[model samples]
Target: MEPMLPEESRFETGLVEVVGGYAELPSGWTVDTPDARDRFDVSRLTRLLRDHERHGRGWPGSGVDDVLVEVSDTGERMRANVVVRDGDEEIRAWGSVHDRAGGRMLFVHIVDRDLPDDVAKVCSDVLFHWAEGQAVAVGSARGLEVQQIDTGAFEDDARQHDWLEGAGFDRVRSWWQMKRPVTPDEATLVPSTDKWESEGVRVRLVGRGADGMPDHDDLRDVHDVLEQAFRDHFNSREETFDEFVHRLREDPGHRWDHWWLAELLDVPDAPQPVGALVATEVSSATGPNGSYVSYIGVLGDARGRGVAKSLLSTVIADAAGRGRDRVTLEVDADSPTGADGLYVGMGWETSYVTESWHRDVPVTGTPRQQG
Candidate 1:
């Protein structure tokens, strides 16, 4: 969740391009090419994705308000551009694949749909080669063999799902992308902070960003809370505090006031800050603006006593106060905690179902021992 330094960023992209380019991919695909230049290309890519999801998955409208791709001819980064022509329709797609930092698997994300089956197959082939190269590069890091190409598509889109399956990927997991509209009337749902008040919990907005430079203590506290809250969740990983600060701040839409910290006073003499909820502004130049719950967490000791619910209530109410039309978040389908149930109880509806397709990077060589 942290921003890698500029050199590190290039390393990720460069590995994908330098290594992935070795394979004989399908025709009409270019890697690290002169294409993927401007907003027009991104628009075409988004329109294809939106149309595909609408028809194939029955989800209307575009989840992505915009798509900003790397647009430079200096050839310093990986910019993959694929244009599949079916009659007069041009199904344009661009993939920006990344290998998980400190991990081996390569993540290939493509927002494309409704292309001719042949064209779609070609895109998958191209992505697999790209991922394979990335895997080898990563393997060289630790003397591993092949790397896995990880991808996801909507669960409902059988065509896309089947294509990925045939392309040697498996549905390893699934998730629910939920959204709830914020109505002014729902202000009643915001539980009074009275109970917490009597218990000596301090609930208030986190300090200012100092013109986008927020206090690190509050931010780190949030990371601590989240790390603790999700420690038992599925596939949880501990993110360093530095990564936490840089990751959130890296988002242009990040707002300081949108971050809220809650402190619990277990002892009359000692007040402990045990929870945090982070939000970011979701803007739409053509539609109503929205708010997204980037992260929300409460310490393990604080659970089951209205702490989580209060956090949700506070965020929902805050979104309404900020004039946001809706709030969105994703929950693991196999969450041990009844997270999906809780969101549903709070009026969040399933907007779509996405499946995680995973294929391990096959390291043909011996594992590299850490020095």
Candidate 2:
């Protein structure tokens, strides 16, 4: 509701396991990072993950999934991992272990860079070792050993590739990171409601509360819509309502006005929206502000009713109205809906590519821990 200041980036040096998302690293693996700060009491660790997850990253994400995926709303994914830090307490490396529901894949995301040689090695070691233990635990639970352990690095980071190969991760595939120039004409091209007025669907800016915050009930509906919408998409996870709200608020340019909720309006008692788009202002150190589509979700029932198009149009138009330089978003190269086609149709073009690399790791079974 209120404009937020960009937080100074700081290192959150420790380990954390989020509510439904954190999967604890297996026992017998020491918390080890050479020449690093011991700033990690449990309290500090808790705040670090929450802050890093909800805001620190300069992007939208829920819990652990934020760092690994291009677009995400958190859901039930058991996640746990550690961030290796330096003497200055900045991140040298970070990694996660997760039991993925969509494909029942035991997943890992490990990344590090720009650290002293030994520290860099420690960073890589932390990720590989944790992932190995996690793979074993998953295999034991599923009655088989894990066949692979997956990890990723930027496409051209030769050093990181060397680390991954040394750690036994393999190169998988590349994902495109696209950007598009937004002009007044493109932004203003939002579809009129005239066509959908009779269909009982209306997309409108989220109503504000008397206290001047977003009407959270509608906000929750937006999350619900997105949760339902992404059910068939890759890496779809059930992000907690709290995670959804907090993560969206993390961006400095978050605005209540930019959030839109689309409802099957004619449907009675209390109209529940079947679609939502959470858009935000993108602040630049220089140049005009830009716009971002934080999330665009439409219930399965609402697809083909023009809900997504309307939401996209509104974001572009809003960006143009504010005289922004451009608009941007990420798309999964493996999306089931061919979502990129829609963005391409709307004039977005690929500006760069990111890769997803993966490999199988062996795991030994251990007795399960009770909840």
Candidate 3:
């Protein structure tokens, strides 16, 4: 890895760093571009940062104010930052610098090179101090507390762990990345239930008009079902109808075919939409893969009616109809509901695990703490 040039070393605090030229941090640390920043890639980065933070290898940087630089051996460039808290018991901070261009993302990779204990401590202290200073700067500029730091991980680096511990950081959790090939037979195996029926449930495929649009009423129902279904899930923020619609439309991979909905027949007079699944055909120059489920939800009242299974089957059928090779989706591994088991039962295998580490801090005006 080349050394980072001097010009790329700018820093910030509160907002996520969107761009930075390139620069090196200290010795033996390299940050560079990643192949892409697709959903899976970003998910991996989140996992690394969270795990490191939980274990004490991470300190809170200036939330979104950190700078991203690209770092390398001969010369390095990547984002960098430090965070500080006035009266917290734990040392909390995180720093990560990545570059995204033309759909590809490059991240700075750091590892604590095998140094003597004394030298390692000094280096760790320097990095941690830098992170703390950055956080303070961000708080001063943005008038917000620098509570958490986020960074990524390189697989199984002992030296990295040592350095993090030396810097007052610890290990958190491990995440996995998994994938399965979509076979022709697998695609054809849609759940059949000609005779299977719930007391008051009915399932049907939704059709979009030639203009590539779903019925306004149906779309609204789908959105409603989703909002209700995820009300209690992790990291969930209640989304308004407009916000939901905007998010889907804003996705680069959004497509009409991957959308699905399930209606509850329990309501005799007017059938209510109880479940919904939205998927997308992700096109990547890196490889040829088919549909990925962006979202899936089943309302509280519709649980255990096999609604989720049915919705997933519908997606598989649709993917096959479109000649898509495989279907992909993500789940919160630690969900109390054991949703991962449901996906596994439906033939989805764990390709990888992504972990999250969080530290909660109280916000100024709000009585509750924010993670």
Candidate 4:
């Protein structure tokens, strides 16, 4: 068997391949490389994919109609693979592809670590070139003046960093994954019960009814509060009502019991839901760790009003009440809102730091020429 390109050979291999303007892949096989398959724990992948499937965000691209494969000398062995023309230009490459409606960006999530020396080297070369090519294609299609690609989860790997550097990508920001113990007493600290009394804020924990679902009105109120609160924050993308609903319902960790809502008592008629928190319980399959906060947000008007502190106290208390051992959340190190200070005050500490690499495709058209 011989290696094939879109115009040559009967087969092709690598991360992506295009044939006659169509992109295709083998049956029972996915675009994920073999090494990726091994590196990501199967169970974690199962959960993540299951979450994606449940949420409808993990669908494969439609443009990948063309198929290509590479076979070894024995005709039965396969070495490398690539899928191309996956319809979604942003997704065609890799990373966390987000369709911004006007244009798209690709976020290459991970790379296979077990790639053969030759295959790995080739992949590195192709990844950079392909990224550049995709940018040009997008730029031509929609007059998309800009393109951005996120290099996901690169940690301490000089080789990977070198490849990205060689490819013209730059490191931008770092994210921290922090965890904290959730004791029954922590719930008392949330102040949902008392902060409201002192500050004249009305807070309530929306509960599930006989139907086992939270009240829609309450949920909508919380969404509005969060949407307004985060409007001016970094990456403050305006999300439609449907988008917000989709995001909430899609969370794999979403549980009705884990959400909270707060309103200002003084603004009874003003639609003042000043604060809200969304949390979920991740039952430890590996052990007995407690629930965690996947996300938390406070409205701008509600900031410095103790709304954030109250919300955290409430969440921690609730987690502790339910016998959870720990609560965890991720924070942007450079949050303009000073959320890090709030978390620290609440006893949350950083465990690990992860960097975010972004290549602004539109602002800078061509890849940064290697130095």
Q: Whole-model Cα lDDT per candidate?
A: 0.62, 0.58, 0.49, 0.53
**Segments of candidate 2 deviating more than 4 angstroms:** 1-119, 130-152, 165-174, 185-200, 266-272, 357-371
**lDDT of candidate 3 over 73-161, digit per residue (tens):** 21222244332111321122233432211111122322233335554444345444455444333223334443333333433445555
- For residues 248-363, what per-residue lDDT tens digits would candidate 2 score against the true structure? 66455678888888877765666668888887777664678788777788887767887777777777777887788788877787777777898999888976555666676554
Please state the error at residue 150 of candidate 3 in Å.
7.0
Candidate 1 Cα errors over 4 Å, as ranges: 1-6, 10-29, 34-37, 59-66, 69-91, 104-106, 111-114, 142-149, 187-198, 209-212, 250-252, 284-287, 363-371
**How does model 2 fare in lDDT?**
0.58
Q: Could you say which candidate leads in lDDT?
A: 1
The sequence of per-residue lDDT tens digits that candidate 4 reaches over residues 258-361 is 77777777865764677888887665645455666765777776677787777777777777767778888888889998888888988889866667766767
Residue by residue across 1-371, what tens digits does model 1's lDDT show? 33333233323345344544423334544444224455555566666656766765675554433333233332222222233333334444445453343343435345355556666666666655555555655555545444555567877777767767776788888888899999876655555422235345666676555465566677767778888888887545455565456556545467777887788767758667788888888876676788888888888787666666677788788778667789988788987777788899999998888878877766654443320
TM-score of each: 0.78, 0.62, 0.53, 0.65
Deviation in angstroms for 371 in model 1? 13
lDDT, model 1, position 196: 33
Q: Could you tell me the TM-score of candidate 2? A: 0.62
Better of 2 and 4 by TM-score: 4
Q: Residue 369 of candidate 4: its Cα lDDT?
A: 22
